[model samples]
Target chain A: NSKVIQTPRYLVKGQGQKAKMRCIPEKGHPVVFWYQQNKNNEFKFLINFQNQEVLQQIDMTEKRFSAECPSNSPCSLEIQSSEAGDSALYLCASSLSRHAETLYFGSGTRLTVL
Target chain B: GDSVTQTEGLVTLTEGLPVMLNCTYQSTYSPFLFWYVQHLNEAPKLLLKSFTDNKRPEHQGFHATLHKSSSSFHLQKSSAQLSDSALYYCALRYTGANTGKLTFGHGTILRVHP
Candidate 1:
């Protein structure tokens, strides 16, 4: 079965602390995406990478959050400083390509900022 | 700016009844629409996708048709099942040359009762 794997299903961090979430894309997939889902179930796009190149990223991701998909390594999204508003479920998804593809998502990492 | 809009926040239906989830999008460039369903404690799974060819995409029992003129890809099912209870997300992929990010709408929660 095609599945995306995410590490640290849950994470807790104090305000101003840094937190990192990891994701392993499905085999043979080339695109990885990161999204943040708030309590209201509103999904906010963070960033997406095609192979090893950064394709597109939202302002929030480029400013406070950083994500990278290195060769043979799990994709990582790191928050430089945790804030109350940053507490949400971070989801990672992988697709065969940018277009004409279905994305396979991993069980999101729920982050809590104290 | 690209955005996805879902009409309903919650819909409760009896099993065997038909289900419809409305989705709309706004984008300057042509958009690729998609539907994703997430069960409790599980990651979101791709349900269907819309292409510019104007053909309806169907998977399992769910289907959606892309209307580029209206910018809608509403999901519909002939018969709702108890297993259909989940959070459904409507998404649109940006087709701009520089952006390949997906914009997701606030999800709709479906509750199918027996």
Candidate 2:
């Protein structure tokens, strides 16, 4: 069992609808990361934050995804307009720090777009 | 850009047989190698990581050695177990500008039968 927590084990949304998922990083962890696992089991890095500051993100995430990790609130990743290609397993992981090599991942939220 | 390549998409084996999964990588800088295992409907968990000192990393009877010259970190186990069936991903973290980002390869599914 991982210490990281993700909400809504499954989510379904229609095209052009909004979809959101939440994740709570492990206690004492200051760095958080989000990844997408497609049907082919290929992993794509979306974004990462260190103590509420965005460290790096992909161009696709910048254009289509909204993500934030605020203090005293669970981190969130929301898609303004869900698309069929966006359907995937959203995984949230956390580490001790920006330089930590090991990441503790949560059970992902499976999103389906129709 | 950093990328990992897993040559085999699937490997089927009988229980008690030796296990080996090939993994190679390309990176501009010397990166940290990691292996993550995901069981059915479960979160991915770290299996092994490469040591900077060139020592082999092992866990649960699995081991991998990072070879900088070959840019490879092949996973191996002397004997396969039924419970070891899962999706295995090879990833690399660039220790350069973006330390939080991880580049992952298409996962290799391991099927161990009795």
Candidate 3:
């Protein structure tokens, strides 16, 4: 059965507004990842975390975009100011370890910025 | 930095026809290769993963072999099915890097016509 869950299956935001998406990783999974899929079907790695610490994030994500996986709380990715270019499918995935022999993904949150 | 290249942007095949999707990678270190399939409006799911100890990985009648010399892990199937129609992405995780992020290819859309 699928374990990863993402809230707000679809989101619509206006330009300059904040867009936030949440994810719940599978139980006992310590590693979580986020990616963005664009219209061209390209998957771009956004950020990843191990436990409660941020591991690696891309340059584009270092600014404007803030993400955290707090202990006992759901992981989240937030866009400070939504842009039409930010409109895409945000995917959340979880793995048992950072090595990630396997990864389970949620249905994803499709964000539309107008 | 690790990178993956999926030669085909799209493939159209008839049911029961042989299928092969080319995937090649570039990494300084021995990389962990993976194949993920995404149905429309769905999150990508792991289809096959390369284990260092295993020569070939197979799932759901799909299989791939990791060749270190070629830096390739091409996904192949004996026959294509209509259900197999989806977007396939090839990804790689560099063990040499401390990050758990996976670099993905542009993805290939497979259309199996009945």
TM-score of each: 0.93, 0.98, 0.97
For every model in order, the TM-score on chain A comes to 0.97, 0.98, 0.97
Once fitted onto the true fold, the runs of candidate 3 whose alpha carbons sit more than 4 angstroms away are: none
- Identify the superior model by lDDT, candidate 1 or candidate 3: 3
Deviation of model 2 at B68, angstroms: 0.8
What's the ranking of the predictions by DockQ, best on top?
2, 3, 1
Which prediction has more favorable DockQ, 1 or 3? 3
Q: Which tens-of-lDDT digit does each residue in A32-56 have in candidate 1?
A: 9998989898888899999889988
CAPRI grade of model 3: medium
Question: For model 2, how does the per-residue alpha-carbon lDDT over A23-113 read when each residue is reduced to its tens digit?
Answer: 9999999989999999999998999999899999989899989999999999999999999999999999999866636899999999999
Would you list the clashing residue pairs of candidate 2? none
State the lDDT at A43 in candidate 1: 86
Q: Put down candidate 3 lDDT per residue, B1-114, tens digits, no spaces.
A: 678999999999999999999999998778799999999877788999999896699999999999988888999999999999999999988555476788899999999999
Q: Number of clashing residue pairs in every model?
A: 0, 0, 0
Native A-B interface contacts kept, per candidate: 0.65, 0.58, 0.62
Q: Give every collision pair in model 1.
A: none
State in Å the error of residue A106, model 3. 0.9
Q: Could you report the DockQ of all the candidates, in the order they appear?
A: 0.63, 0.67, 0.66
Candidate 1 regions with alpha-carbon error over 4 angstroms: B94-96
